[model samples]
Target: MDRKEQPLVSIVIPAYNNENTIIATLESIRNQSYKNIEIIIIDDNSKDKTLQLVTEQQKKDNRIKIYHNSTNLGMIGNWNKCIQMSNGEFVKLVCADDLLDKNEIEKETGVMILNPSVNLVESDTRLIDINGKKTGSFKRYHKSGLVKGKKIARTSIIWNNFFGAPVNNLIRKSVLDKTGYFDEQFTYILDFDMWMKIACTGDVYIIHELLNSFRIRNDSNTGNLIGKDRETYVAEHQRLVDKYAGELQLNRFEYAFSIWFRKFRNAAIGIYLRVFAK
Candidate 1:
């Protein structure tokens, strides 16, 4: 396809203090098969060399653009900043520590091109360690096809998985416009809330191929925030449930069951991390 014919994809990276892994993140975007993309990085007052590394990469590639915030806006704030800066039809939020396979853009954007109604699409993703080694692997919930918006929300709440992180997904900017920005109240599960909010508006498409890498560090946001704040995590889960209960059409029985089941699951994960995780 000609350059003009292709839709511009905005790959937004919201960085905080990710100096060690920012280069790999930039390289993954630089190697994407789809050419017409603008890489937007918003540095949230990083005390490390995260901005310096991104600035170096920006010099090499014209598609890369870097911005810095005078004050720390936190995670959700930084994400909203990325959205405000992006001018693309499609927006993908990639973590500063994660990696996208070379063909991820080609394939995921293809899904959007073929299915005009799909406002969101996600690919399978694997977990990697700090050294970039594949530490674990598993398949996501949905198969390769289009799923109804309500069904996606139902499955997410019933299973309590929230699909996966935003790194595994490409979202339509129009849908985001309807849903608005990420809510800062959610310390954790912000990505999950955004996914559900988008899914409520239109259909969600899934590509069952593993095309992204999510780094698992002990100090990563999930490990540092969600891991330490189980109570807050549970509260956030309940808040989302209350916010979307009418949209999900969930009854009292279903809501109660889901809350307890998710609590049990969280407890099990905590036990496993304490007993087995290294």
Candidate 2:
């Protein structure tokens, strides 16, 4: 495809200590069916070989550009840097350890072009264990086709729907310019908060096909949080509930009950994992 014929898509990968999985992740992007892509990798001062591996890969593919931080920028900080470095019409963030289907870029970009009103496009996600074996399916907003921004926001918040990880979504550059990127304050619920904000800003399109694999590893951030730092998870979940209470139109009782229910459920899950899972 000529440079002018195909629009550029920027895929930003934020990496820390992911030496073991970084190669496979990069390979997935390099093998994508979409030919016009710019792969930007931001290494957040990884103590391991993550940067070295990415640098070597960058030497081979002109499309892949690697940037290293002199000091650790943390997850949110590095993500913002990735956004700043991207120069594509469509942007996607693929974690260092996750995998994307070869055709994901092609399919998602086509969807975005065909539906001009949609600012965000998300697809069904599948789960893969540490060994890359298929584990299960990830939940997504059920309704497909063009969806209203306010309705998507309200239903996702009120009905307890799970918006899969950022890896499953493709976002427009214009929307990012309007929404102003992910809020850095959110620790666990950053993606969730961003999704809600994006949905409220404009239309969202959902694709029913599975286009990415979210790897489940014990060392991953969410895994570490859920395993030993569950209190942080519970706190962040509560924070989001509190922040969006008015948007969901929750009455006082409904707000209080939702908070209580979330606390109870999270506490129970933590206890169960601590006991029998041991």
Give all TM-scores, in the order shown: 0.95, 0.91
Q: Please write out the lDDT profile of model 2 over residues 1-278, one tens digit for every residue.
A: 56568889999999999999999999999999998999999999999999889889988899999899999998899888998899999999999889999999998899888988888888888878777877677766778877776676766665554566889888888888888887877876688888888887878888888899988765577666666677787677667777777776767776666566666656664554444331
* lDDT per model vs. reference: 0.85, 0.81
- Residue 222 Cα positional deviation in candidate 1, in Å, after optimal superposition: 1.0
Error of 1 at 273 (Å): 4.8
Task: Give a tens-digit lDDT track for model 1, residues 34-152.
Answer: 99999999999999998898898888999998899999998889999999999899999999999999999989899999998999888888878777878665455655689887787
TM value for model 2: 0.91
Highest lDDT model number = 1
lDDT measured at residue 155 in model 1 versus the true structure, 0 to 100: 80
Model 1 has an lDDT value of 0.85
